[model samples]
Target: MYPSSLFQALLLSATLVPNVFAQSSTTTDPTQRAELALSALQIWYNAGSGLWNTCGWWNSANVMTMVSNLAKHDSGNAQLVNLATRIFANTIVQAPAKNPQPGVESQSATKRSNGNETYDLFNSTGKESGYYKMIGEDAEPITIFPKDWDKAEYIDVKNLPIMQPKEQVTTVAASNPNDWLDGFYDDDLWWALGWIGAYDVTKDTQYLTLAEGIFKAVTKAWPTACGNGGIWWSWQKDYMNAIANELFLSTAAHLANRVQDSDKAFYVDWAKRELDWFTNSGMINERGTINDGLTNDCKNNNRTTWSYNQGVILGGLVELNKASPDATYLPLAARIAKAAISELSDSDGVMHDACGPLCGGDASQFKGIFARNLQILHDAAPDAAYVKSIQANAGSIWDNNRDEGNMLSINWAGPFIAPANASTHSSSMDALVAAISVN
Candidate 1:
């Protein structure tokens, strides 16, 4: 972790300094912009956890992937390569410590079964000595029940027993210490892709093996009930969301290309199977963009058309096209990319999420996913529009959406917001790296 005092000093200097990049004309260069964005991002890095602070489990994978992409894009820069190498090594060692099983006690009271008894913990009124609802730091409600009802013991809310329902316990055992598997299949998929990207840039067999292990672990959650296809979003198998399935397809296709020919057919087959299911899954609406996930009846939920939802599938299709040499994959990816740019971009052609200005933690990471994946598709089949969109967004992020400290905001187009953290910075870093790649 960086020293808090020094970090604050840097932020203070960022505010006082009139354009920190003004000393050099290279400031306008895409590569230099990416380097500056990276420096700002590292300020939030927690070396002990092998993860960036202020972001959730999956976002760290994207952060790692972004760094790896920069390493690849600026391979001639030995300093950048060395920084990427150190980050890869440190994260592999420290990230596992952050992974843990989601315990039963963390489950919400409403999710638990209690003989049809409804506990409106958020609104229930009680006497001074009776049970009361207390809000947790995450804004979730906690019901503090009296420990000894017979004794009429008036225990404080902090000392009282938390109400829990009777249900089967959820336990997750890691395959190995290095395994970064979590309760969410999507989280594992993100790390798998991150490690694969690392392996691509570094040619480290260990990273490849780690990614393979993650892919294997996630395959166990492939649901047969969802018309005998698609990976579940989590171990609970409650929702088969777009991100999880998109990552599954991308991981499988990427592995197929990287693995040896004898083992190649297995991954290719899985990739093709996943693509078939996802294309027919009804999640992709007529607009060529995807919704969140399916409803209970396996119909389109028609949820928000998130940028990442459009973005991740582009990468998956690009990889599958490479692995299987399908003529249609690239065109399909192009259609989705075009639709996303048309739907998500503002009058100025800068991308923004439906819940913009404050897209919260997760959605803040969405637009960058689109930017990078669109670059992938553009690399496969060159498009002037894709390049224009990327350059425009990158320009906006640097000129309009960034703070004096070189930190990026969730909004790519406009005034900078306060409290920009790892998710927002890394997501914008994706745009910078993509711009460099396209150039």
Candidate 2:
């Protein structure tokens, strides 16, 4: 439920660790270093599907956008343009429409403490349980490319029929638009971010309009009911949390900076209102880091600040600074970035979330979001240490987390410990591609 490319793991890094970016600045050319790391990750792209071999709709959406962003910046790869073209074609046509296929569905009717947050979506056995694919999904089967694809298990798809959409109703999430929001506000935001990235690369008015349209509709749900002015975690409106609101603020601010003349002011006003309300809302706890959300009574809920929660907001703040040019926004972003890097990472300095390895689809996408935003922060603020952190993460990803098939594990800390999925792979790809921006 987060940033699109991760748009997930990019949160805080400048505070805890020493200047990793600053130190790395003296090494080989920053672009070259980034190119090498990025080149390693290129193996994951699938020509057949016009997507990264990432399996799920949300993950593939992120991978496509991340690849697009990288292609835009990486001068070494002229071919990335062609790849982005192929990928976008696939993304649009394959996008799940209103109704879903037989036996594939979302389970929004299930009761829970937090809508879609309390339980794991699928069975570990990866089998079906009727009316639901896996327990966590609010609906039926979506397509999931398996981990084997990363290992060159089926390379022929790159040339011929691009990977066919294999309907995976067993343990996947919903795919269609009607229920795409499926009570999870953050999921919608994640998809919107992907569209935003697509818009960024193509200059296609349609992509920007699509993202802006989602933001327009989503903001309608920002109820002021709880004294806490934040987006609800789910469409069910049962809970309000950090990631969703952070995504909301950043996304609105980003769209404000990008949209055409008529819509700009509306998004800007929304961004400002959200930032002012959020900063004073007590979600950014005493730790100088953000907590999950307010309690039902509107007190600080004190939930663990997952890496993604910390990661997503920086982009909003940076864009807001550009829009309004206020001195305060960058400092706020810098302070949080410091806290995230120092506090949220593992011993090796790779970013991680509060969820650990058991983190399913949503959490799987966290760290990459952190990495991408961290680079953004660094670019705007000139935090060289952030580059060091990015470099460290790139090295660790290759050394400890990547598998024989080149798929990345969920934990950057290592052991290939969990079920390797597209979410994890794309999140790592975010960090890897981000290596180019810094030294």
Candidate 3:
């Protein structure tokens, strides 16, 4: 169970922590800081490819979404626009919406060359495409389905799933804690949203088409398994996470607004269906915040209230209302946004997640998604509190979170520690870039 009070939660956290570090200090600004931060981030870019080469392909997708958002908000930032253009042109080798390579390189080169090795395999979902893994930093490639013959999810490389044009899966399964949803449904959700973000920036119908196709594939996979509504986290189809469903709803609604005239109803219907099922799915707890997901038994497993869970549904609801002009959507979105600000924030109002100091490859991406959506809420509703919270966190991101190269190493309400990496930096970039756009 979660702590009933913020004070109780903080006390539990402090007592549980093994050690604490002093806070870092730096000066702050929103727009200027975002620009300064990007200058530092560009160091991670690979000149060999226009991609932000320092991170895994998934994180690089997030980086692209962030760059596009930055360009959209800060129209005067010519460099940001140029970066987006370059990435779109040169990143053909990266796909769902990418080009396939045809060279004779080592497995290491192939995986990294594909730029699709975050979870480490191309066919992450068993129902998805591609069929290989790159082990460790050497980027060694191997087939994904050979742990044991008895496993149901395992399949030989030669028998890979026949994928539709939009059903591109990247990343690999892991054996560490087990590789159940490495190419998680949520991952496709992220990729779909990233493609949408790219579409929003470029206005190229190809990006929109790619997103539409991905959405089509995702909707086709909506399961009758546990409760007959939510999409499974992966092809393994054991547990369903809240984030994936939220992304599903958001993607559907977002696409409904973006697609060509005839296709609008298809996506809009999906958006409504998903939102209806999700709200009643028992994931939303009594405090009005979302739980992580359902247990194998399909009951509310009562996981932690992640900032992203609270964050994502807000955007989904807002978009749902925008697409259909329903009275329910915006108010629901506003409620979640209000709950997130009240519950998930620290005394200083910067967002906080319990999974830290190192929230691993995935959780690193959460708060920025939160910030980006919060900006969305502010945009639709024009709340003073929302804008101020965004600006404060955005500015403080520069002040407290900055490390050696201005890469924000986790802990949004921070005494920042840990070395910076592409995931941490690029995710935080979303929040800072959002600050510029909120007003």
Top candidate when judged by lDDT against the true structure: 1
- Residue range 1-439, candidate 3, lDDT tens digits: 1112324323322331122122113334466566656655654554233345335545566677787777678766554555454455344332322211111011121121222211211222223334223222321112242233111221111122221122222322111111112344565566667767766766766666766766665664475355567776654445677877998999899998998879889889998989888888888888788888887667887877778888888888888888899888888887788887888787888887766666766567778888888888888888888887887777667777877545687877677867776678877888888887664
lDDT of 2: 0.62
lDDT of 1 by residue, 338-422 (tens): 9989998998889988778787667789899999899999998999999999999999898888876688988899788887999
TM-score of each: 0.80, 0.73, 0.73
Query: Positional deviation of 156 in candidate 1, in angstroms?
Result: 40
Best by TM-score: 1
lDDT for 182 (candidate 3)? 30
lDDT of 2 by residue, 199-246 (tens): 666667666766776676577556533553667665445556787788
Q: Between 1 and 2, whose lDDT is larger?
A: 1
lDDT of each: 0.74, 0.62, 0.63
Flag regions of model 1 displaced more than 4 Å.
5-20, 23-26, 102-178
Q: Which stretches of candidate 3 lie over 4 Å from their true place?
A: 1-29, 47-54, 95-183
Residue 310, model 1, lDDT: 95
Model 2 off-target regions past 4 Å? 1-55, 98-181
